[model samples]
Target: MSRHLLLGVALLAALHSAYAGGKVLMLLQSEKNIDRFSSFTDALTAAGFTIEIKGYKDSSLKLREYGTWLYDDLVLFAPKAEGFGGSIDQQTILDFVDSGHNVLLGVNSDVSEAMRNLAAEFGVDLDDRGTKVYDHFHYAVKEDGKQDHTLIAATDLVDSPVMVGGPYKQPILFRGLAASVPSNSELATVVLSAPGTAYSHDPKKSMIEPPALMVGAAASLVTAVQARNNARMVVAGSVEMFSNDIFNSQVTVNGASTATANKDFCVTLTRWAFQDRGVLVASNLRHHLLGSEEQPWGYRVNDDVEFLVDVMEHEGGVAKPYKADDIQLEFIMLNPYVRVPLQHDGQGTFSLRFKVPDVYGVFKYFIDYSHRGYSYIKLTHQVPVRPFKHDEYERFLVCAYPYYASAASVMAAFFALGFFFLYHK
Candidate 1:
């Protein structure tokens, strides 16, 4: 089927498509406890998302219709399904994301290979089949004396406010397997990590050797990835964590009972994944002379120039100017000639003033901002730098007085020699 893919569009293009409550397509399993995630779906709806739920094997399921994408975001809640129905498949979902859409994937202990493949494509490696995360030290106490130690009360969240919204005051109940995220990956961020004493292994089997696969904080329970195109994806280990039961249940960590913070965290995560928060777009990139607004055709060596841009963060269908102190600009040719931090005006405008280097060539104004939990923004504007014209040079200079005197003396001597020759003849 033909797809109207939105590639190379401006950063605001995605936001504009989602400003009027973007459509979300959720694929779920019928046999599974679908009713459990009502709280999560309700939260997404409350946050201005038009959700359309479909069974994993629904024949009518289609991501694109009439050569246009039908949804702006997707939710994969059927982790055990081997493959999707109709025309939906792993590549279809990938293509959806490649076009700058969003996805929220939830996997369980019985996660299928297809789900693993999808997670792997986003740089998250799910543990082997039949294995689950075991946190004996921080396991939540069940009501009926069940000794299953897989229900973990994870508290090791990434220390990023933009990702998690804020510090989680209470523990999040996570009962699922563990995954690994690349430590050096700039696109992937570990949202939740297993406790230091946690390990992943087959609960039914005995320990033959120490668990080497995933252990401690290295085992990630939740990870978020923002692709280079600014498409967002959240890989969650436990689909049950979004259930209404877990959302309303209480979690005990170290014998202290506290209400689960899963609802708040899940809502925040959904909001981020669906582009309701932490989305940034830059506009009106302007550069001109220091004292004038008109941009010249080209810059001169050592010329003073001013640069300005507006950056806005969209949330709750409203756009507000982004405020930050670390946004920078790079004046570049083959290498950066000037790298300076822009000053914000309390609104969303960031401006900078600097003198052009004493070299003449092609230059570009580059802004590459990538903050945790926020959409990536890269803007570049190229302009030429011309050398001084002949008339532009100074007619007289104190440093060249000696050379001027020498040239004048030579001319006078030649004229005197001609006069002497004529008179002697």
Candidate 2:
């Protein structure tokens, strides 16, 4: 019986692992001959994830029948598909993203309206003046002095260790043709851009006039969006950037040739988009008055209070301290009563000290810390301030001592007169 019970428990554990729901579903296009899905899947699986690739042309499978949440992540490699099958439309994809799932959408040189509208939802304009990107100044010069505009290289990556990787000893270079424009919509931020030497134009046609958009002023070749709910999306103009051909290609820019695989960039970017990196969390947030073990229900005026926050990076199956420079705090009561900058004292502790305001009533000590590339930390401690009690008021004043003396003298005179009249009568 004991052996049977152990066996049953082991089987249950296996079933739980199988249905863990953290798997990634890659939706690939049938028309495209790209087989790089296995490479990306392998990387994610090696990092302890279960990935499943599904081609849209498979008539036996239905996305709507798979239920609301078949996977935790979705990768759209089906840019050329005019539309999706099995209840997977624009609204379905948007709802999937809005439900806190990660998405990696790739746009080819020939993009469709569905992909364009989806990119627009994230504030990225794939149609920049209705032309492909071609750089004259940063193009690769052929042996005969002709510029090659198709296989351009970019080495300027965002210097964020969390988004890219820790202390990137080597830079990532990309060789492909992709163009993007900046997003003017709210809550969208650009991540990477081309150098000033690059510009966008039609490859098939000749340039009659100067290009309308330049490199620096243009949006970004590769952009990432972090939604309000912490759901992430990485949109790239080139799907071949993740292929083994480009991943193993060498890039030479401005006489400096470097042989580096695009795999590093792809892996780091995918990890970031899939919520494996750049995740900040606040764990233990505490506040109290000075010299007290118990958090006070109320505070007196000018009371010294100390606030501490334990910030951490929740990634890689470990919760570790997050040491960063851009975190801030605010102590607010009606408006911002005190704006204090928390200083990390070389430990996991972020703390600050300030005297309580002189105003009396219910007030809150607030810490509103929001930084780019990190999760926001908001904490509030509701503390009531009490006015002075009856005995707490000033007992003896110099100006009021004469009034006290006069009242005492009158009382004494009345007592003496009453005693004398009674004895004489």
Candidate 3:
């Protein structure tokens, strides 16, 4: 009986651990051994996540066979999925994130066309087959004193402490590939960039001329995308960036020895990718007449109106006010008739005051607040704008008084002429 009780307690402890850590589904493109991904999962485990490994061809990836809800988050480290033999289509992964889950995707050398297609759907692109980002000037030297330009050190991690956390402003090691983001495409942000001297091409071949595009800082070594549902996705150009070897390896750049910042980067990135940070929400919404307690029946063309909203950010499972410099309010009809900035009062209160637009119609009070490395906040309130009521109009019109007097005089003259004609006759 004592032994049985001990076993029961152990089972309960295991269950508690799994529940506390949060189940994560990690998918590999190839069915080969997964020893390479241990360090990647280790980083996440440190962040309180339990990683579940599976191959892309596994029966469990089927849309009907398995659902994305089985896990809290996903880490897809499939760089070479040519056919990706599974019932799980590209849309299945998107649907998973659309339901408010998060995903982290990594790509390495020999990027497959199938991966490119999937990335394109998410507004990101991967490099062609066998292409890697080679920086002859800034490549790190291996421990054996061999110089490989393909292995680079990137520092252009875009300015977002909330995502990068500590150990930011340091160089991260990259070993493979790069991508190009369209100048106007806003779905993805370049989190890490290759240096200006770097050009992406096959390292084996001698190039007569540099590649046309996907060069220099424009070549994105890593990017982060936040879906419309606030489901975050991180696309990395190199899978080895999250590997144990790279994390522990020392790098020599320009004959100076330094430790790689990849370990810290991997931890912070895992936190951000899984929604541990950079989450924001808005609440306590209030809007009414500028100086009155009662809500107006409707807003006139020239009415003083005030708008208020309480915005807070999510961190460490707590929501706190996110102080920011730019929060805007737009009074919209078919198009924006008025656009004004909201002022924060050192707390979470974002307050704004503006006269109602002269035009009267169905207007929406639109608050679109978005910044890099933060959750998006979009709030809208529908309100009707109306013309002045009959009683609300001015009692007297000075501009029309002269016209009114002239009309009265004309009537009097015509009546008197008719009276004269009748009497004389």
Query: Candidates' TM-scores?
Result: 0.91, 0.80, 0.81
| Model 1, span 1-425: residue lDDT tens | 22334353544576566653589988887736557788888888887888888889998889998779989999998989999888899999999999999999999999999999999998899998788888778888755556558889888988877677758778889988789987788899989999999999986889888687599988999999999998999999999889899899865667777788899998898888877888897998998998798988889998999999999988777888899999989999999999999999989999999999999999999999988888888999999998899999999999999999999999999999999999996
Clashes of each: 0, 1, 0
Those runs of model 3 whose alpha carbons end farther than 4 Å from true positions after fitting are: 1-22, 29-39, 62-68, 83-87, 166-169, 204-206, 394-425
Q: Judge candidate 2 against the unseen true structure and give its global Cα lDDT, from 0 to 1.
A: 0.68
Task: Give the top-scoring candidate (TM-score).
Answer: 1
Q: If ranked by TM-score, best first, what sequence of candidates would result? A: 1, 3, 2
Which residue pairs clash within candidate 3? none
Per-residue CA lDDT of model 2 for 74-97, tens digit only, reads 888777777876657778778878
Pitting candidate 2 against candidate 3, the one with the higher TM-score is 3
Task: Tell me the tens digit of each residue's lDDT in model 3 across 72-92.
Answer: 787777877765456666787
- Candidate 1 lDDT: 0.88
Which pairs of residues clash in candidate 1, taking residues 3 or more apart in a chain or in different chains?
Answer: none
> TM-score for model 1?
0.91
Minimum summed lDDT over a 10-residue window in model 2 is located at 168-177
Better of 1 and 2 by TM-score: 1
